[model samples]
Target: MTAAEPNRGLIHFSPRSGWMNDPNGLLHYRGTYHFYFQHAPGSLVWDTMHWGHATSPDLVRWTEQPIALDPAIHPGDLWSGGGVVDLRNTSGLKSGDHDPIVVFSGTQGVRMFYSLDGGFTFTPYDGGRVIAQPSGRESRDPKVVWHEPTGQWAMVVWSDADGNGVDFFVSPDLLQWERTSRYAAGWFFECPDFTPMDLDGETVWVLRDARGSYVVGAFDGRTFTTAWTSPQTITTNPGAAGSDYYAAQSFDNVDRTVTMAWQGGNHGATWTGNASFPVEQELVGTPDGPRVLSRPVDEIRTLRHDTQSWPEATFSAGTHVLGEGCTAELEIAGASRACTLRIRGCFDVPVAPDETLRLLVDRGQLAVFSGLDYRCLNVDLDRRAAGDEIALVTDGPLRVSSLVLHQLRP
Candidate 1:
């Protein structure tokens, strides 16, 4: 069925066949990046769960590998989870050949899986023992991070225990886990991701749910407390469009915060979803509060071929054509509220003066990434062949400080 699907993205990663959701087991091992996800290989929709994998040396080019975990071979539903590299053999599961990789997933309780050959394959740890059990009900998606300050591993898993929250757990060896505390909020749903970012030289832990709603706080290995009890959203009114950016997670063992998310609307005739181009995240202070900003990884530049730029210009309300190509990367700065750029007649992306919106047109997929904020929008262009001419329409006369378009190399 891989018969040259025209709708497939030029740079985005998608499964060869079937459905994919919520990236899992994301980590960097040695020289390659291992990307794992919730996959249904037999159908175009969510069905049987399996761990679909791909490896990348630069995050731009991906090579699909065999299924890493299957429901038939691995126990439980093989739900969404995260992994970590036990570099010090703290788990004692290492065989001296490779560092042990441990991932967690399940429904009511968390199950553990380990890989000896790096992230290429996995085996059920302790014959499928519930490493971390759910507190109340409706639990899934466990994200783990190593706490350097405490010299232990910390985890955050979404659960309905006491009505919507994440259960915090700490493990010394990855084999045994101890439930530390439960951080509950009605807004927290599923697919919880945790990252400790340096904000002005101080480390602050950010916990974000599937919908891009995040809370900034402090973590002392045992508990997470935040003065910002309300919450700040990276993306709003998402899921109202075709595919909301969801289930974003940062890579393990990376020097900086790098994230990737599932673009739910990116479905072709063969594949049901695609990964939003990888982004490097930074914690910055905004007038609202401390927010996380994201931009496409610089490695995406290697895919650029013909580059065009307008350093400064004034534009009227009309379609300003830039290039003639179906696949291209765009960086438009000097956003004006009077501008609402339309992409290929399929998406109406709004522009704010403080935001630099990046539009990525990949055949039938138009992904809009708001650089300053983590807001993202994916327009489903699967039905119509996207317009080859990339253009921006202004609501009124606007001043643009910068505009650049790079045609993606096939």
Candidate 2:
């Protein structure tokens, strides 16, 4: 079968046949990356949930695989959740040797399945044990991870106890789980992911909020007591610029972490249909704080075509065409404070207000409009102060840097 098209400068990996949400089971096994996601096999609308599978040799180019687990196998229906590879076989299901185990959550309870002959097919362990079912009906979407120090398993599940928060649980042998505590109960904390990262110098817990914000905290295994001092928001969407991106999940790939999310929502134009891209998350030190910036992984460096760099350019309002599928960066100089840089393309025009700016894989025409209502779409800046500024820089294969322009305001 032919592989799916590459995700431009962004690594795209959503279901080619249906709706996708809440990336789950992001694990690296044996030398390949395997991840599961909540999927419905016919539309962009969320209906029934099944585990959509995909594998990547490099974290960027992905090959869509068969459905990992189907909810129809059980009676209740499969919900959104995560998966992990049991390296040591802590469940004690083997006869002569240990095997890799896959643990996930369903509507009934948390379930366990293992692949003895390799990860080709999986069978439930102990007839799919129900690890924990507190209150019995309101718990779903489990995020499980194995704690190295404790040598036990830790899980975070979605609950409605305090208005849609994540409940904590610990299991010694992947069977009996005890409810430990509760974390931030926001409006709707759908997919809760906790990973330890070395930030600056201290180890911090990165928590992704489905509603909007991405929070980092100091976690101590038992509880995430410390609130995130530096709160950052994720604002990029893959399928369409205006579509809603939600339920993002991440996994460690040894050298870097890769993330995926649901592409569209209950409402939107639904242009590209339903799909998503895998983004390599990087911790960049911004003027504001330690922010997470995502881009298509460096493996895509193999796909570069005709790179260009313009050292500098004066700001005169006119249409500037940089070839299709290009990467551009602009550094601003001689600015009183901040200026507005607008990117016009096939997607909605994205305006960035500042000194340093970056745009990736943008196609369509570029134009500078005037007036608050955008009355003049083809106007040029007049007599803009000129200085010895590195206005525009483009390296071959379409990488541009240091382009400066002012935002059109009311």
**lDDT of each prediction vs. the true structure?**
0.82, 0.53
For candidate 2, the TM-score is 0.73
Alpha-carbon runs more than 4 Å astray in model 2: 1-11, 74-76, 94-99, 135-137, 228-232, 236-243, 252-255, 265-275, 282-295, 313-316, 325-354, 362-410
Q: Positional deviation of 162 in candidate 2, in angstroms?
A: 3.7
Worst lDDT 10-window in candidate 2: 371-380
Would you give me the overall lDDT of model 2?
0.53
> What TM-score, to 2 decimals, does candidate 1 have?
0.92
lDDT of 2 by residue, 1-410 (tens): 21222221123444566666667777777677776777777665677777777887766566778877776563335677777766666766654453564647665466665566445456766666676764434777787776666778888887777466777788877767888878754544566776666677666667766633567665556676655544456653222322446666777435466666654432222312233345566555666566666654455555444454444434333334433322332323332233334332323233333233333321111212211111101111111212112122222122223443322110
For model 1, the stretches where C-alpha displacement exceeds 4 angstroms are 1-3, 240-242, 314-318, 335-342, 345-355, 394-399
TM-score against native, each model: 0.92, 0.73
With candidate 1 superimposed using the best TM-score fit, by how many Å does residue 260's alpha carbon deviate from the native? Answer: 1.2
